[model samples]
Target: MKGVSLAPGDYIHFKSQVPLHKIPIGTKQWRYYDFGPKVVSPLICLPGIAGTADIYYKQIMSLSMKGYRVISVDIPQVWNHQEWIQSFEKFLDVINVHHIHLYGTSLGGFLAQLFAQHRPRRVKSLILSNAFLETRSFAAAMPWAPIVGWSPSFLLKRYVLTGIRDGPHEPFIADSVDFVVSQVETLSRDDLASRLTLTVDTATVEPLLLSDSFITIMDTNNYSAIPQQLKDQLSERYPGARRAYLKTGGDFPFLSRPDEVNLHLQLHLRQVGVEARPDLVQSIPKGGTGGSPSKESDKKKDPDDQPKDNGGNPESTSEESQLPPSSEIHSLDDQLLSDARICSMGHEDAIILMQSQYTVVNRILQSACELFIFSLLPIYVESSYVTSNNVWKFRQLM
Candidate 1:
């Protein structure tokens, strides 16, 4: 149970690939996961009240693999906003990162903005999701904010967990909530107390000197822990800020909707002049083309295994003439056909296509020619694990 993951094996894999770094700057302990290349500018991820550095594992895994530097850090123990900001600044100094792109959620978002406002030159861009412009409502709700430091750990956890809605949720959202609960279980009495104190500290972010173009306000269209009015107010405040809106990702979109969130983050980084060093990405050998898959599906057939076409027009099956099935498609063969237009049903189902002795993963509905767009798409997977993190991958039929 200790090594179990709510969302498959992401946690285990994350720990294996990225080492945890705990550096003490004065009395504050800086815990974080710094991944990807060190040369490029870093993107610092800060989480909300119930979050830790590990909460942004999805971001670290995806971006870091693509040669982007991502530092997902825990907010150092601090009583007030100034201390938090100063401690973060010193932590960055200790890390030797001169400038950064900040990504924050909830209370972390406020701290990101505050830091940006105070140290304008040090922050290149900001991406705030489900964050607040002010904590007035929270302070008002918890009249005993001053006593939070003295509150029991269980009480503090309850206060934090109550904010995360409990009940039936979509599969991904439910998994995300479960994962956050697991993270909360790891927090110490001081951790929860410090975050709760920040939440109810009644501080507001001042007008930032950074341009709106360098800011991206990401949030779900569906309900979240943050108030509607607060989100609206933040939007209104930054009229020129890039608005990356998702359909329904709840409170923790980074965990629930990592694909969309990572996509937005990449776009933000590109817009802010932080380029990804794709050359630094390492190649892992997977079965099929040049190697063997870790676990070959019983129904899978490699190009070498298939009979050669006489005319070389690529053999068209009967299923290729029609749209693929609408039900739950488990295998790649059952999911794909010769005609890409027919194979792509646009239901957001994963499809695998084997061609030219290589495997291609087709994730999104994409275009009529799935393989053609594979190179054009930024998040496209060239070749990946046949089964990664206990999740099936997508490959476009070339």
Candidate 2:
């Protein structure tokens, strides 16, 4: 019943739109997805134990397109909280992003608070999702934390996956869960073990200098892997913090309920005084912010805009539905043809062009890539074209 849209299509769109970058700060290798204009202060997202940087592809796609700088990062295999703080500091320094708005989920939330507590100036604001204030209860439950690193991958995955509740979920929620399971499957033994170790490690987030007004506690109302008591304690800790509660976003609101989550994020960004890049603010296609496309992109509504119907609904294709109407596919084929011409002209070897993988590749090609993804990929999303695995095989075409 559920249509998986993010993979090979939207997901590959994300990959093409915002290329992944790995920055090695000494022993710690950080894998992250960064997008949007470089001028604005970036909103950095940290995922929980069962997730990876790719988990926030929705955030990257939705917000970055609208002019916000969003960076989604994976939790490296750091053993402890103190090391995490240090490694994270070095990561920021390497990237040269002086100030950031930290958005963390579960363990990532706890880590965000922990980092803000230690390095107050670097963090402009904090958004904690399904986060806890302390690890005492977690440590108590995981009595075998000391031996976590030695645990086998299956055992570690079992332990980490226990946090996500199992049930007959709605199609979207089921798709979200399926996506998460796929991400968890990508984790290395050390990655899973270290994340579990951090969850159980005895650490508490102390009070911070940042105002509660600058913090947004975004949590799901339904159910969370983190206990309700912890969520309550966190709310109590920062009584002045803004509350952005979702009506029904299970553990991963940013995944299962993206529009709501993105809405909250944009509001929080505004509250925190972070401005969208002015140059990009109006150029957003489809849902335009008063900016018109240039001469080249004349007919194209922002190339990144999802393929939508005349009713303004995202054109969705369930397993039960037929291929999208020919007009739409024809539109996509034309843009992809344009994209091919652009890529070929930009680089002598088209293969090298795709391989170069610059984040921006400048505005002209950025729009071209966006056109390439939205034009070609949505057809794949709206109809079952191929699995995400096949997307990697797309490289073999070159």
Candidate 3:
């Protein structure tokens, strides 16, 4: 809730930068940041529980630099999944965005899936990062429902922060976490409780079956708030989803690892035939353009002249175009591995690795504190005389 201050020159720069827009949806106003060109299929960013549209500043600026329209939203205070989806659809309609490429992190990722399932035709692609299918495990781990609605706002904010503060020691991650915590502090008890309810509420989600829409799943290598089991479940649910791993950026990689995230995004966009902005054409390095056909003239070739796959999409005739040139794939693979090492080690090793990093030690400690606090919650609830009837009453109120 802290306002960004700008000097005279800074004010000019800030205004030239992405400007925030407020759209009225029914009685409530939805705030958002819109960037990049209006022509392309816009990359709509949806933030997690502790996020606002501003948190995606790095991604918006970076992706826009590469010629993609990007928009990030401050989700309205709507708790019901179906209602939220309906409101979101109306929001998009108001903005005149017929189709969008979605980039959702954590809670936002879950909502993105719901939106896509509910309105599949409007989605061009999906990028789900550090998100899961359901909240059963999370709800079981932290049984704060009885107290969440009545607890002091700071306590609730602290609890939320402890759970998600895990990230590398980078300044960007630290600053982002700090900003999120600040925003969290501004939430009223009702707002916090509503968000918590939304987090744990169960809903059935079917597999998103949009063939034309590219699907990519991104997660951090070293640390993830999302469980491995949930990640596996997502893969099982979306079989065609291309799995991309980030080496170091932890929960909020878009802020921490913009370059890498942007690369994958650019490649995916090219694969689906979204054109880059003309001004940013030279930003992509020479020799690798995600194997997209370079010449616009090539797109007009005769059907007979074009090679066809079994599925009938155009197939590159030459070996160089068949797949990303081996060199490019190798380079990208090496970068991915270097940036995000997959977690294949034991729990002890993982803990040691996490603790050894001075930058991330505080984050690990915060998570530990969260778990410790969670352990004490049941006792606190018992002492506070919170009963099943009280829980039922609270649920009804919600």
- Per-candidate TM-scores read 0.70, 0.70, 0.65
- What are the clashing pairs of model 1? 287-292, 287-293, 360-395, 360-396, 361-394, 361-395, 361-396, 362-394, 362-395, 362-396
lDDT of 3 by residue, 1-398 (tens): 11121112212232343445665669656777655544456788898877777777666655655556677887777767888889898877655566788888888888998898999888878888988787777677776664555677777777777787554467656644555665666667666765676677767567776662488888888776678898878777777788889888867787667668878787888877777564533333322221112344234432123321111112222222111112221244554553333212224543445345644766889999999999999998896776776888999999
Q: lDDT per residue, candidate 2, 198-244, as tens digits?
A: 98888888899999999999988888888899999999999999999
The clash tally of candidate 1 reads 10
Residue lDDT tens for model 1, 1-398: 21123224545445544556666679987777665544567798999988898889888766755557788888877988888878988877665566789999988998899999889989989999998889889989897888999999999988899999888899879878888888888899999999888888887888889999999999999889999999988998899999999999999999888878888998899998887665544422111111111122223343223311111111111111111112332232322221122213332222111221122223333454776676556543423333452353233322
> How far is 381's C-alpha from truth in model 2 (Å)?
52
Q: Which sequence of candidate numbers ranks them by lDDT, best first?
A: 2, 1, 3
Task: Tell me which of candidates 1 and 3 scores higher on lDDT.
Answer: 1
Model 2 alpha-carbon miss at residue 171, Å: 1.3
lDDT accuracy of residue 333 in candidate 1: 31
Worst 10 residues of 1 by lDDT: 285-294
Question: Which is the better candidate, 1 or 3, if ranked by TM-score?
Answer: 1
Clashing pairs in 2: 285-302
